[model samples]
Target: MADGQWWRDAVIYQVHPRSFADSNGDGVGDLNGVRSRLPHLRDLGVDAVWLSPFYVSPQADGGYDVADYRAVDPLFGTPADAEALIADAHALGLRVLVDLVPNHSSDRHDWFRRAPAGGPGSPARDRYHFRPGRGARGELPPNDWHSLFGGPAWTRAADPDGSPGDWYLHLFAPEQPDFNWANPEVAEEFRAILRFWPVRGVDGFRVDVAHGLVKAEGLPDHGRSARLLDLTSTPFWDQDGVHEVYRDWRRLLDSYPGERIGVAEAWGRTPVRTANYVRPDELHQAFNFHHLTCSWEPAALRAVVDDSLAAMRAVGAPATWLLSNHDVVRHATRLAPGADRARAATLLMLALPGSAYLYQGEELGLPEVVDLPDASRRDPAFRRTGGRDGHRDGCRVPLPWHGDRPPYGFGPAGGPSRLPQPDDWAELSAAAQDGVPGSTLELYRAALAPRRAHPALGGGDDLVWLPGDDAVLAFERGAGDEVLRCAANAGGHPVEVEVGPAGELLLSSAPVDHDGAHVVLPPDTAIWWIPARAPRAAPASAPAPASTPMAAQTPTRSSTSALGPPPP
Candidate 1:
């Protein structure tokens, strides 16, 4: 990859500010907290850090409901603290990408606040999706669109006439009113917000809800499916006009000295539709949610991998692989049947032909804290849905840096964390795994070291799948002497396979036994091999064992044995 185009194959760490670290005793994480953790990221060997929203907010949706784009929230820190964090990350040779919520803003936002006080046809109301209701007395919403959290997407607006008046559209929580992108003033305001961050030395932005910015010309009812996942023909998402908005943002980003990028957090109906967001003239990259949502079944995973690679190649953009982020359950808990499977998945993801994103505590193999108290839940979806499937707070608990108790060194001594962290996280704390051999932290560090040092490992769109059983997925990256082979066994038992000319074993997610011509791969494992020679004859299958599959066992809290012994 070119020096300036560092993001193409880079490993970007997603840091949710409120959970990463808390420098202050206020029980909240701040930018200064992030600045202090720069060395941890540098040592962990990530190329960049993608911070979730820290902009001014009412904390309605974990900072996603932005009150101001330009200012840092007091809960996070001052604008100076943000600049210092950026400078510190750069000094550690890490790029900084901040989250930008363009789809909506907090109802407390200056524009949103002023818009409600005006009449239906006022200029202030035009800045948002403000329209009169369908019924004669304006009792019903303008349309039947539903909020992503739940309930009606449109909420009644208090009018200047002191009557139940026009309803404004909010695709998410009512506190987060969607912007009227059709308004010229809205587009220009965002362009200026785009310019504001780069001036502070931020490398780029991870554009929140990028595909939901522009809606259909008419605020029509979403006739059939109101599900958020069905974005293909949706009136509110992935509209054609969204591309023009991105094209404009692209121009502003490219104007900067560095190859400043815009990564779309877009969800599309198909890989091709998702790829459209990253066309040459538009955004630089988009999160591959297809790969993230794929199951552990070999056929499903292979399909997603193949489709993702082909789709991204079609757009001349590198595929971005992410296992977990702030909104979903951590991959360690959601994807794998056990810790071993999670480790294998990580190895498989890192070896893929694209950029990779790592969630904050994922390096330490943190599992989702699924049982946070109802009172401690802060996600808007949970409250809006009356505690249904909106359990995102489980994945946003504070990180355990050190110590053996609550807060786990996340904040000041004896001070509680903003969200309840599981007591079992003591074993997964960074301090506990820092130098331990065979630990998840070590495996990640070891894996990333070579990924950065090896030319064939990073930044390439070349992958040739090797013939193997349905349970095993093997592929070679690059070609000739610069080649590296990666294989994963997503099965119930060990499988022996011929890895063309038996190269040197660089790393393995689990222990492997090689017998010159055939390599025995354990179930729920993956490996990276550096090629040493040409193709070899295939090996015969070994007899199946009578024991139960390894998937039956629940992984222990601190199970580094799942990763096997340290690399020789």
Candidate 2:
């Protein structure tokens, strides 16, 4: 193993601040709420906490539309709360990583205010993409490209209509205009921002929508409007010149001494093309959201895994995997009702040979909240749904800390609570499932704890997939002296898998059937085994002593009847 390479096999827990916990009765989660929950996270055994944007913003795009990159949003908490989180997280031996949104800022940002007027010599003026207007309507200007959240890419500025003022470009929503990376000042300006946070003790950053940084020049008009669409922004996104920008940023981050992880949110087509962002100096890893986004099917999963592996091997690039994030519906709902396949997916995720990011509530197997009142919905996607299914607010619901709270363990309790407690948390709260033998949460702990202890599982290379019944995807991971085999059942029915003589079951999501030449696995489950006399296998390790058993607990919480649907 390499020094500080632990992140290569590490599992990152992504905490969405607004829904994590609310400290005061303001009905929003804050940093202090996060600090209060540190013990729960530490006990969960994550390598690091990847916090979503907490920067100052106008709240038009959640926190993505940053107004002041350096300051914390008062809604989230003060800078001291952030410092306290870092201090507490470090004390628990967990690393901290913050989100860095370099693509764009809110239209309300100070830079936009000064630019509309002829602030000719202003440095911030050129930071945004500004071009001469092109449209029939004096108020309405520019291209036919639609936003990712569903709307025209360009909006009328506050400036006088029919003026010669230039129009700004926003790929996602009109509220969030894209930045001009072509400007050397913008690139250097962000590099300076990168250097500023490490002083506050952030270990690294999760670069949000990184490939969206640069846009094609010439300002050509897109032909049609399409929701969740990409207009190519002039063909500059994911372009060749991006590599130089990454290289420059990497060099600047290297000055921090210890390794600084840079995992890019790269959303592109082919796995091979996405791998280009993960080369040695470009970016430590480019997130692999392919499998997570696809429909649940064995063949699909197999193809994605194979393609991803081939892509990385071909480019000699490191890889990172994410099953779900704030943007989409929760995996539990995707896999089965109430996220039934969460444990099985978790097993497969960790068994893979790369870094993995686990979204909050995934361990608890929480389902996505589909019903949100129009008055409460906040996401742009939900708004455009025409009062149909709510947007990401369902997946972004507040963390369930206790069982008695509303929404089956989500926001604040009773008539009123200090934070936005869930209505009925007893069903899915960590306290409710911690010791249950068959709980999804415990199974995750059982499986993940071993990865940290076993070098073969954590640091091996050269994984070989062994054929089994169509239901099972069997594979062995080994590099040099370390070797281990993982056999998993990806079907709804049990399947028999044959390994070798005298192999022992190290961990199982269900009872293993070790009879005859083949072992049987329960429906939608998996188990790992090691050779009895392998030369390079890491020594066997046990689950932490304090971990509780499943049988002793009763369902202490109520149903989803208590709390209302998630915030809009």
Candidate 3:
């Protein structure tokens, strides 16, 4: 609503740094690689760029186990490289957001390393959750908790004298020991960590495990955890104490220049619980995972959208939408029917009111590499969960920038990507689609450029659902002269729907048959159309926005306006 609140409507691109781009022939993406690619983001028209963990880490859990929050991992680059990347991004009119891992640290971290040496009742041990075993000989784990990566959350460590001293809590891998947020020193240390990045011009943080940090008091025994979209299944997540930590971060962000913000990577028990992280006095926004988890059915999509919007609106926060990320199967494959369905979903997500997040390589229509050999797999979930949802490595495959061979220009000819690219990635390379009409890359560019500048799009809450069949979702956003119609055919076979008066066929996820009033949308296709007619007048008792003529046209569409809906 104000100049400083750019996050409310930002389109942020998530960069999995190690897989995004590689420079210096190292077969690894570094901060300088990100800097070199700033122009691509500028051209793509995203408002901001978010980097996943690149801090000093052991590559355990893919950088989530942080050893040093302030230093850059040599695998990525130096601190100077990070600053240069931030500066370059800003120069290219992009804001920079870094991932923050405050819930836990690498077991190799100095503090965690010295924890055992300090012995029981020591300040170092106090920083983390270290408890005595439950049995007489102290052989059993302290609690009934399970690690998110799979197995016992508690790992027993030897005492300074080499005896089994105490068991430490690690919600994820044993290398990632959870911090004791109950401790004042833990909060104070994070306070300084929060202050460290802004001075270097970080626009915001995408808080990792934002729903975590504060566990239920007394570390109560909880049953086996279910890995689901709802993170609050157990006492460890969505606790009331988590909000206080975010509120403190909000205050710290507000005091900083550049409108610094924090966006939660939180998955709550419900949309309402998720909204708590984005309250006016808390963080700027929380990711709405429904877009990724919701089914492709029309009713399901609309329901999740309404639920997400209502929840965020209650807190005066803008909703966030996403489809695929590094942690899940790429939507290109998950949504199936290949690129068309994925493209259709993209339009639907963009037409909705909120900030949108795009994962790296999504525009290139990359599908999940599901067949990676077992020996090449790196996701710990492979072993931890007995291969349940362990395909994260599939989505983390390095992006192919150009060229037509293996690696597809990801690195030097002899240098290989950390993860293998699919054989067909040659045509999917950005170079292959650079100027190809109807290419996924071009479609994204078309949608993003308009979504960025369209008067009624980007930031607003004025969306009205238009009547349509159960297979169709039709809605108009903005008001009066600035109105734009969006609809999706989330069904099999074609369905024709009347969308009031004639509108310009501005964009379509796929070719569709439509006139001014009626459109026949194919299964898994969507459209962004606008009516050309006299503007609605405001009530005599109220002020009205000045009517502006709608003349902007950008997306490439085959106008079947004269053909009407195809026979079905």
Candidate 4:
């Protein structure tokens, strides 16, 4: 890939800062912790790391409720630490993309704090959507729109006169007041925020709620059953005006050097609508939630892949594939029954055309901590619904870096993690799997090495479906001598398939036995085959030594919540 288009085929690792590594014995991951781990990512063979939100916030919704975009929260570290971490990552040939929460701001933000002190119609109020409530005594909410977490979207404000106050819009928790994008000051402020971090040396941003900056012109009632995943034509999401905001931001990003980019966490009803966010003049990429939501069934996975590739191709953008992120149950637990299936799924994801996103801890085969106590649940979604729906905290537990006990070196000894780690995680800890042949960690290392070195592995937007049984998915990427083929068996039983003259075994998610003319694919396994003439060499960067000690400590008490939406 060219300098400006590295993201096109890059393998980007998502680092949930709080759960990654804790420095200073605070039990919370910080910038210095990330800096210390730069060699880990460099050795993993990924081109970049996408850090989750670590901005100054009230922690009501993790760091997504930004109190100050330009400042780093004390729980994570200081501004100087952020700059040093970015520089260190770049030094390791890894780009850094920090999370940007543009949809809303913490209620504790200066603007939000001062707005309530002003009367209902004051300019301060205009910066956000503060309107009078409906009904004779202003008892009713302004509209029927619901918060993504739960309950009414509008929350009553404190009036300057000490009377029943006007309502403010918050698509998420009440602690996060939605910005009035229609207001010029709102746009100008965000534009300033966009420039602030890049000037500090961030390579780009992963825009949270990228489809939600603009609401419908009238803030009309949605008038339907409100659910977090029900985003179809909602008044508060995916509005046409959001594109204008991105176009302006894109211009500002292009003005910077080092090919700075913007990635969108956009959820649209269709692939075409999702592609709109990545138009050449707008953001650089958008997550393919369609693929993430796909079932393990061969037909479903095939369709999602086909549609995603086509939609991205139409807009001349790369299709970014991901299996599990922080908000969802880990794929090892959610996609199928075990680790083998998750490995196969990942292999399939990595072999496809375009970029891939690997969530932190996934390489270690960590499953979701599903048994977290009710008292330990911290997601606002869970609190809002009284634990009926959201349990995202299960996936946000601190990672087990080493040792064979709880916290597993996740933090300094004697300190407890913010979220509990299961005792069984010892088997899945990085320390246990590191350098173990055929381990999931090694599988990822092996896969990523070739992805970076073999030209046929990561680049290309074309895929040709090869004939296979109903339970099998087969496709070839690239053309001529560079062609690479991938076949995945989703069935529960082994399936023998013909190996054409072009087939040369390159990598497999599971053990595969081959005869003179056929290859036997194991159940829930995927394999990558390339032309025999394809070049093979060690990856440019070597893997980190097994004994390289990472800072493992417990999490400190902080109010941070989960960073993004609950997975669908």
Candidate 3: regions farther than 4 A off = 228-233, 499-502, 515-517, 534-568
Per-residue lDDT of candidate 2, residues 470-546 (tens digit) = 77777888654556778667777878776456555566665555653456777666667676566633323333222
lDDT of candidate model 3 versus the reference: 0.81
Tell me the tens digit of each residue's lDDT in model 3 across 128-207: 99999999989999989888788889999889999988999998889999999999998988889889999998988999
Q: Residue 567 in candidate 3 has what lDDT?
A: 13
Q: Per-candidate TM vs. native?
A: 0.93, 0.88, 0.93, 0.93
Q: What are the runs in model 4 whose C-alpha is more than 4 Å off?
A: 500-502, 532-568
Distance from true location, Cα of 363 in model 4, Å: 0.6
Q: In candidate 1, what residue range of length 10 has the lowest lDDT sum?
A: 537-546
RMSD of each: 5.7, 6.2, 6.9, 7.0
Per the 3 Å backbone cut-off, how many clashing residue pairs does candidate 3 have? 1
Q: Which tens-of-lDDT digit does each residue in 1-568 have in candidate 1?
A: 5767777889999999998899997888888998888888887878899999998899899999999999999999998999999988887788899999999999999998899687888899898999888877879989989898988899998888787888999999999999998889999999999989999999899999988998888888887647667775689988888999999999999899979999999998888999999999999899999999988889999999999999999989999898999989999999767788889999899999889999999989999988788999988878888998588888889999999997888998799789988878899999998766557887787677656656677677888888878899898887665777888998888988775454555566765676545578888898777666733211111111213222221222233222322121
Ranking by lDDT: 1, 4, 3, 2
The candidate 3 region of ten consecutive residues with least summed lDDT is: 559-568
For model 2, state the Cα shift of residue 340 in Å: 4.2
Instruction: State in Å the error of residue 183, model 4.
Output: 0.3
Winner by lDDT: 1
The parts of candidate 2 lying over 4 Å away from their true place are 119-125, 136-140, 160-165, 224-236, 337-340, 385-390, 407-425, 479-481, 499-501, 511-518, 535-568
